[model samples]
Target: MATPTPPVVPHQGRRRASGALEGEVLAALQRAGAPLTPREVQATLSGELTYSTVVTILSRLHGKEVLTRTPRGRAYAYAPLTDEAGLAARRMHKVLDGRADREVVLTRFADGLNDEDAALLRRLLTGAVPGPW
Candidate 1:
């Protein structure tokens, strides 16, 4: 009889959520404070992720309009358009833009906000210059 091959073992680690890799890549770019090539980004990630994986993530982020790229030597360098807060706002706008009933959506969103956030929103709507978040 032929000998059976040993079972393949899965890597032991906590599962990463969807988009987690993208987020990590974005964070690395943001921390860089300047555009970085795929290899640089991979190095910034401490080589935890593969070079091709970093390139793919950067490409995906660029495709999503979250990042901008420019030609740098043989490879393109990537940079984020804004900080994390701006990205969050963009996501919120995207969600709102997808709905037909914007008013209802806004109302529900406002209603779900806690008192502190509601007050902050109220101040923002009233053109009041609020303090730092």
Candidate 2:
């Protein structure tokens, strides 16, 4: 009987900031106003990152529905389905909605903000007041 080979194990450690790369790629696409191949993204990153790594990240992001890709010759050009802000808002909403008490969740969210952020949020909610507080 032939011996079976063991399955390969994935690297375990701090996970890659795949979300950040997706955001960056999306921003680059928005700036370019067109689809970009992995090579293009690698060139844009310059010496800060490796081409193959960027390609892998792009492929993973594309699989995650964070990005859309179109075949261009032997390679694919990828673009983001939504902007970073929209993606972040969707994720935040998902997290908040999963809670049992939405009111408490929102209250805690407000309370977690820094003083400046809280004040700014209050101002936005109440609109601009001409007089000083």
TM-score of each: 0.88, 0.58
Query: How close to the true structure is residue 40 of candidate 2, measured as C-alpha lDDT?
Result: 88
TM-score of 1: 0.88
Per-candidate Cα lDDT values, in order, are 0.93, 0.79
Best by TM-score: 1
lDDT tens readout by residue for model 1, 1-133: 9999999998878866649999999999999999999999999888988898889999999989999999999999999999999999899999999999999999999999999999989999887966455
The stretch of ten residues in a row with the least summed lDDT in candidate 2 is: 124-133
* Clash count for each candidate, listed in order shown: 0, 0
RMSD to the hidden true structure, all candidates = 2.9, 7.5
Error of 1 at 4 (Å): 7.6
Error of 1 at 93 (Å): 0.4
Quickly count the clashes in candidate 2: 0
Query: What would the per-residue lDDT of candidate 2 be over residues 1-133, giving only the tens digit for each residue?
Result: 9999999998765654866776676677767767899888877766455788788888887776777899999999988877667677777888997999999999999999999989987887788644332
Off by over 4 Å in 2: 1-26, 97-101, 113-133
Q: Whose lDDT is greatest here?
A: 1
